[model samples]
Target: MHNAEIAMIGLGVMGKSLALNLVDHGFQVAGFDLNSDNVARAQQEAATLAAMPGKGRFLAAANLTELLAQLATPRVIALSVPAGAVVDQVTDELLAAGLQPEDIVIDTGNSLWTDTEVRERRYQGKLRFFSTAVSGGEAGARHGPSLMASGDPSAWQYVKPMWHAIAAKVDADGMPVGPFDDGEACAAYLGPAGAGHYVKMVHNGIEYADMQLICEVYHYLSEVLAMPAADIGQVFARWNQGVLNSYLMEISADILQTRDPETDRPFVEVVLDKAGQKGTGLWTAVNSLQEGTPAPTIAQAVFARAMSSQKTQRITAASLFKAQAKSASVPDREAVLDDLHDALYCAKLAVYAQGFDLLKTTSERQGWQLDFAAIAKIWRAGCIIRAIFLQQVTAAYQQNPALENLLFAEHFRTELAERATGWRSAVANAALQGVPMPGIGSALSYFDALRCAVLPANLLQAQRDYFGSHTYSRTDQPEADKFHLTWNATPRVQQAQ
Candidate 1:
């Protein structure tokens, strides 16, 4: 739209909220949605707002023609549609409707980075493409959402004020834990088209892992201490005051504390233990595997949810095996809570570390200015998994923007050293007592990956050298670039020289 307000192509919950935010920021906005209901709702919401003091009002275009007529040829239309083929479908349709390459199309959905990569190529030098991951869901979308966007750096400047107008505030640690009450909340550019989605993908992946670890902690309490949900929640609430303080953990406590309206019993029992997973968590696990990243906890969390989906089979099978609700003799509640929290804190760090490592690796391979510390700050505010530790991540990035990896950072090293022992013991205990602590195992894996001196695959070195004349390094002299190789015996041959 020639010097017009931001236009939205999909006016669903997220789009509507973003549109309203634009309106609130004094941008004369125009929107179009396939669903008539959403279109009508936008109109209704617009009608309820205070009369514009001096700006133009928001309009819901009746059709593509109407929307095109309202905006400039190279429109700044953001798509909040579903990811995958549908995104491409909309882009193609918009192109057919005379949307020029000079136009800007922002995909504010959780599209795979690959999609963004492809779209960038397909658009070539014509249109601009941005893969933006919008966080904060329904509520955050309206007031403010942490925006991770990547595209033409020049075009980025055009909408930056809008991003600032809508983002959450960052803290001293550079994390986003709240809306920018003073006008600096959640949004920032993440580099290029696919960069935003890639970062967001990792964010969700970490979220998956973080939530599972919290659940595992609860599992340890319920099985070992026979503690009820509320009591376990109290333990988490206490942890919230320390290093483990986080949005997910805090919400978990709220869920447990919530009472039923009818029975006055806990509302958790009323809700299904069987949680359903959308594909992003699983996609993240798959991405990690393909990229040779250590994402065990997130992968396990995805699997755990899948297993939860088999409720009917699980219920039926419980009858097949005669089992007692055996309770392990728990240590003192205070002691157990402290130990578990120490374990949880370490595990959570490991989880974030693993994810950040992946980002570092990805940024190196691809050209994305990840700004790990900035990302950590953004995660702090507008997302589902906002935690206090993200500040550390942000600071780490700010100090060394080209930080090759996270574990090598000095402060992180100190933090890990202090908490890792207890975390390791927690995992060992879980393994010893048959506790399913995938999150802890993942956390352990982070330490293992960062140790540099040892690797589980090192045992295969001899075998590696035996077959292909491949070389192997000795643990004794790792700092030295020396490697040992056992060449396969070859038939006697004269030297070519």
Candidate 2:
């Protein structure tokens, strides 16, 4: 126990599971929690693992001082605490408890990337501050999870071996290599300071878009096509075996088929409709705006969640505004489904494109030098957004690291071109039928806008100039040269300083 390799603070579900995972990988762990019961439970699980051959032990520490004493010199401690002030509190407490210089602290919470940056600078002289954004929830923690590590390269040197051992592994083809398969670890050094957390934020943003798009597809199938939950589940199961295969889609299919034991209704139908978010998606949308990057699909997904929360208002509005008249003729169900699958695939491309573009823009602005291909490769498994589609994304980046947008990739470009007609038809049909398809519709709009060379922005600029005197740059003139119009004067336009 005195030779414990690492210490884990906050033995909640994620913390405890991760501690056990390290023990399973034969790393001695010293675990502590504010809740004594949590520490006891983790100790019991660790004891069970230690009983097995080739497993390491877990030392339960009573306090911060004891936790530090159990670890070796230059201790490596991981905090699974809630993000924000609590993290700072723990760090300060550790400092007060005789945590020495050169000791490494890893924050494994869903922290804002900027906060990570602040902490790194705040803790610079006292100790090494590192952050690793962990994804895949509790189960993934107990077995394996995608790890995005950043901050303090020296600290990473000490932490890398353990992180890699416990991280989810993937095959050469970008498919998840399960426990039995031989594959490389999903962990990698993303960049400096807040790079890892920023990547994780963007990952959550894409996840929001992905889930909403799937839900919108489900809504179309259930409401417009008159399909039962189980029937829709079957459709999703079929899709899961194809190009759209993903962890989200696979679970979504399973969820749709589940029954509520109490009322004998579909599990989804029994559950409340209001969605919950923990701010990462909103952060991504906000960051995109600040960076001047267009991420309409991601923004629309966040908006859809917000709209879902207004259940009472929606119910009242539904009563006041009668439903639109049904279409004169019902669409062919199979044809619609085919179109939907294509539409979903195309929209997914847009969603990923936006997420990656945001990452690239932020990386350039922040000097993170993030490896887009590596990010895509790691995401192919052990994450909420894991999908076969990411394999293509990985190849796209590997083929050309400077890929401006995912839509421009040859593989994705061909897919989008081939599926554009069906994608458009599905969206048009959804609109005509009065079905809301915000995620899908916004993605299509984004795609169309990107492809258009000339937009209505010229008039927009003119209007801005007319009202606000904001100067406009002309296509004929150098972009750096600006012009203003005096609409009331005889001369319509004049050069501006």
Candidate 3:
């Protein structure tokens, strides 16, 4: 039997969208899923799209054996299953099916990067394992998505054509470039082993911060300004016209504009406050802490989600401690709105700074030769966090690849400085109005901490030494030297070395 070009397992939403995208690129695709219904649906969808220009053939496989049989020698299979043990389970099944050593297996899910590393180690010699973190959601999957692929060079070479063909492309202005567009695709070999997943994790972490900041702005507008949802929706629409223009911001405006048919109320008003998470954001936060990377903005965003999940406890607490008066007097509505925009933009700078800083540290530790510029370029279009500002970021890295932080980039640094007053005013007003702005608040704190030349950590160390005997370093002493002082009055006011 003649083999197909590629095969995708697990025909769920993302999987099916990807399969169709592959088909649209003129690659014959074989798709399989445990559920016959999904396979049948995929077949029907593919058949409908067969008339489109560049459309390729689609084959539905009933089982693993059939799926393997349909693929050519040196088969390239994509696994879009859930993360965790299930990924390993599928890999073992493929290995057991007598697949050749050179065959390629690509995992396209939000699995932890560490797990990807382990999987690569375990699958060594048995088969070539690679991972690609896809962003842009279902629509992205079907059209174009930002792809971050990493693994063996040989395996990447085998799949690079498809990756490039299906990924989003952007022109010089960061506008979406079509399949026929004259621009580079938003896909690249990130690094070795788990670098792709790691970069993707960083993307999601920044997304959490971006989303939380927007929510804070919405909360302040709703509760403090008492603005109608439609009016607030208008504000988001305007924000999307400026540097804040992004996929997430665009959706936020849409969500606010949407009305509920049941009560004719704004859909957002009827939606529950409780938020759900799938662990990627938490993983980013935890990894940042483990690496001793200062990522308060991302960490605070994760904490905000955790705080949101306590809907029941919050309801009870609200009744016990009646709402307080506004934290501060509300300024003129127009003035406040302008300040809020600058505040949000400034906070966003901090979020990306922290996320990229984390990525830099991880890349160094893992020996991954990451291209920060390429990463930014990919995120310029297809990702959830794609923003016009990303174009500037890409430029910043291109100008200086060893950029320490986004805040240090001349463009962002100067902009943040110019926006400082408004940022401060927004955060202070939020506090005065009794609105929680953990994400923005943490960002401001991180910004301040970064600029501080000397912190009070010296005193903190002294206190720690006084109580727990933790050694303290003196300003006059080298970093390797440690000193301890006895706070209690005993004899020579004891000093220890």
Candidate 4:
């Protein structure tokens, strides 16, 4: 099985990494790239590489025509490219250029969920399509990507062996449930075309929120606590010891510790502060709003990145700065750390909450039974955002399968109560001193959302009465159909049944 036919399209960072991974794992891989240089180099590299664990050999396709002719009829084609209309165009090209109907085409790009659905139906009865989300960035792309795949169930079963060769392990509960044995825990046929993308969309959304919140904590420690980035890095390193620990926080520590050549200071300062979003965050926010789910943490992070881009407004504001900067009041370092830990933990939970809600809502809309607990476990390792606290989330879901939100989890509530006071104090301290802590603001908003008594805008029924003549009853009045027209300042028109 060292020569299983695999053809990879695109020779960019992700494509190159994955193509090489296939070559390493002993699978006979044929690689193609639009760029002449990259393709040639990849060809040279593939031929030179030795057999790796569970992968195959190497072949290079000079062009589309050559590649198609060289590979077996029912080839496994991997598409690693930019998302949106580009995917459709490329797929169309493949079909137009004599790609076989029995071929297995996998889209490893982070395409939109709706588009994946459309593509699946468009190619129905013609070919098998798998929409998979691959994580771990460029480096992880080669070693292995934590992949979420969804397509025809039978097709997924046929491709299971290849999927395992490319995925990390652990069941959905984050428990060390599966070995690198029977199956790949990190990858699964999430039930249909859009499901994988739906999960990945929410994944990026949570990522945006998590990174922004981390930045806030960084600012508080640096600007307020007068701690060095190196010290902050050390703290994050220590956080890995407990449930609050994660891969993002771990890399954050390394990033903080990395030094700059010119200033002899942390390289974090040298890097541009203006956070750049790649549209996934915005897409996640829009979807949440459309589905009537509250994704405040991720939404705030997108907004925070926007604020970072406004350097000129900030410079202008700083020109008239109040000369008296607040002097530091040294509280118990351990106690303050405890507060940060609690706040970070709670804020992170909110990020996951937003993402899970997105998945859940999407699942309902799509008619799929996606196990929430399973996603948590698979994310525990081999993903960019892997964190120790994922174990807690996994356990939380396991304890109560039917629970609506993570906030209602008993274990989480008990944990929050123990340290929430310090967290609140830390957030308040930043607010009092006029520090623009977007992450902290998001954390506060998350707390408020958890404790929110009533979402007034939840009155979709009243609006229904104003338009389509559907009626809603208050919590106190179960059977009443009268519309609450005074709030909208419009007369309600009741439709005869």
Candidate 5:
């Protein structure tokens, strides 16, 4: 009788890598894919792993029936299929193929959080529907990745050990620990239903903002400062040694220094300027709007990508409207560099603050009760956004779990206070140089708006009340009491009728 502890339904890159990870951790896995070639590749890789000592075997099945037959009773199935309809289709097939009520199905794709909730409801009682948002791309899949799991509490118990075994590890200081290192796994059960996916979505939104902020800095260094690509890469490498150290920063340095094989030019220069995005960032932005939360940096990052996609229009517009010439006098290079560094750090703080605030707001609304500190700790390694910076975030939440915003944290408050001058200087320079810094600029504005006790919304309220009868609340009275007014109250002439 064939016996396997778990079954994997998709054998794409992520699927294959995860299956291999499971086998490496001494868990027997039954794997299946629609494509015969993928199955063969998995089998070959499994053979290689099987040769190694202290590894479990991989069994390739021709069909779902055979796959289920290979698994042990009350089987646990993990799906890495595409986000939308494919997930439902596979779940339906598994039910048809004798998946029992006690069996657990975990969706490990970047599905919309609402969809995850819907699926859990749709498959309730028939089978345990669960989800875990996996991050760190293909390499992390093969080695270790940060996992955010949610759904039925009972299902979590069944999958916890397997997830912890394959998740990346980190030390107390948030430094990534190697496989042999004695460290804690970067995996945790976030909450019920869509909480895990919701956290992952916010992670992606912050990622978008972080990437755009870096690109804006690169643009300033390259276009405004006229620095060479290699020089900028060196600068990025240096920055990666400090607070800005992160997976994206490290990869960006490598990308910059790399040369295209055909043209022998800087790899970045050879690539197209247009950036593509999946739907996660858009979902984050839309959700922020729906929740009445301010996430301008994240929203602007999404818009930046949208603007980049219209490259042809930008090209024509470039010729049509001329920008004012920049001043010929160059500022002190060292001072400017320092300003940019501090500016980036400050903007990054704002981005995280926005992301966390959104998460907190949604968690309360959904009754998820997500542990902010735990979430930050898990993100310390094996995720795209992993950084030492997250250590401070973890500390902030640990000190005060009900923190209104990250910017209000004592540590972050001091950081912003010390860095405000540099942040202002950097934004001013970018504007004067005619370089677009939407991510950083929007972040600065978000910070200022939060700091302000009184804003110009009074006039805005009046305008709204005038046109749409959307009554305005008086500043002197309780906000619950709204009032309206009639402006142009002069008596009408009798002849007008």
Candidate 6:
């Protein structure tokens, strides 16, 4: 019977789990993959997991023709293939597979938002193309994930029920306390054409900054404080109970506690320091620059990753620098730890501020009506950066939708004020001890520069004008009235000895 409510292509880790998740939510799911083995494996997984209190049908289609044949009319299909060229290939294949103009297609991968925009325009009137950025990785797909959807409103409406059913739920306090009667789904309609993916890109950028902050703390604990990895895990565990609570922080603690089976030492100790990325963070950084937004925290995180890649150069430099430096010193251990925690909190606020600023600029530039509150709400669960802190973000936007920057929110401003002393103390101490704290350090600088009403940029503009005849705006005149001055008044003549 061709009564399958929805179809999913690409039965890889995320795809298969999402298919099963739909099935568990009582939606008849038809799934297909290019590899026959993958199809068989997905079928087996669905069967094993379907035993748990679900009454939906699951169909495994051997090919695209079979998959479409099983789906109901006005078909809804989701693609989970690798982003970039593969997505275009799949869409072309679907068109070739006799998909009607009325049918809908959803791309739920890490495709660049601009690429999504182009795809939407390409498929306009030919087929309804949608982009929904899924977060929370494998575990989220298997259970529930945060869904950010964009493109056609009709497409969003068609998938709304399924999205809500399979998305993570948040409690009244905006914490992920698991699915329950009194909770909200972590999914929303972001806007048209690329808005959803753009938001997801910002999420990944903030993730990079957040991760670097955690690593900096870990570095301080290990190198400066002489704490063992297991003990450092305890510090993270304690922090997770406070305002610094987050899924990433919790997992970081868990990772530090894990013992390497071979040597029976903490797994983190044996792991290499080099970091790898999948481009989204870099996209966010580049987009920030394009938008003329200051996202130094995110940019610094990307630089940190790149710097870590030069292991040999850094090792030699460390030895060379060691000879010129005095031994690192610290105040009371507990006091330093307390200050570091507050500094981390302050830096985290800066990172998220920069990310949201990028989103705000992008929304204005692209004409997408993005709801910051809704974005924050959806991120309260399932997504990698989910935290109790996002509840504060939701509240900030709710209090003032027109809030220009997150740091301008009264609550956050007060929080920063209360923690300013400790934050400064931590930064000063780290700098004095020759410990690198790029994430927090960059955040502090960004915040200070953001709040400064006067800056040295006027001199920069004058220098530009002197060198290249670039116009400079006067402080006493309207900014639109550009002025330029000739720095060298001497008449041009050939120099002679």
Model 6 reaches what TM-score against the true structure? Answer: 0.96
Better of 1 and 2 by TM-score: 2
Q: Per-residue lDDT tens digits of candidate 4, residues 78-158?
A: 898899887877777777767776777889998988889899899887678877788879867776667888887766765
Candidate 2 local Cα displacement, residue 457, angstroms: 0.3
Q: Residue by residue across 416-473, what tens digits does model 1's lDDT show?
A: 7887777777787777666678777867876776676756676676677666656776
Q: Tell me the spans in candidate 1 whose CA falls farther than 4 Å from its real position.
A: 1-3, 52-56, 72-74, 171-180, 316-330, 464-497
Q: What are the lDDT figures for the candidates, one per model?
A: 0.78, 0.93, 0.91, 0.77, 0.93, 0.90
Would you give me the overall lDDT of model 2? 0.93
Model 4 alpha-carbon drift over 4 Å, by segment: 1-4, 51-55, 170-184, 321-328, 454-476, 484-497
In order of TM-score, best first, we have 2, 5, 3, 6, 4, 1
Pitting candidate 5 against candidate 6, the one with the higher lDDT is 5
TM-scores, all models, native as reference: 0.88, 0.97, 0.97, 0.88, 0.97, 0.96
lDDT winner between candidates 1 and 2: 2
Q: Write the per-residue lDDT of candidate 2 for residues 1-497, one digit (tens) a residue.
A: 46899999999999999999999999999989999999889988888889999898898888999999999978999999999999999999999999877999999999999999999999999999999999999988888898999999999999999988998898877778774367988788999989999999999999999999999999999889889999999999999999999999999999999999999999999889999999999999999999999999999999999999999999998899886735648778899999999999999999999999999999998988899999998888788899998888988999999999989999998999899999999899888888899999999999999999999999999999989999999999999999997789745566797
lDDT of model 4 at residue 278? 88
- Global local distance difference test of model 1: 0.78
RMSD of each: 5.4, 3.1, 2.7, 5.4, 3.2, 3.2
lDDT of 3: 0.91
lDDT value, residue 90 of candidate 5? 97
Q: After superposition, which runs of candidate 5 have C-alpha atoms over 4 Å from their true positions? A: 490-497
Model 3 scores worst on lDDT over the 10 consecutive residues at: 322-331
- lDDT by residue (1-497, candidate 5, tens digit) is 46899889899999999999999989999999999998899999999999989899999998999999998877999998999999999999999999988999999999999999999999998999999999989988888899999999999998999999999999867899885477899999999999999999999999999999999999999987898888889999999999899998899888889999999999999899999999899999999999999999999999999999999999998998796547858878888889999999999999999999999999999999999999999899989989889999999999999999999999999999999899999999999888999999999999999999999998999999889888999879999998887757736568964
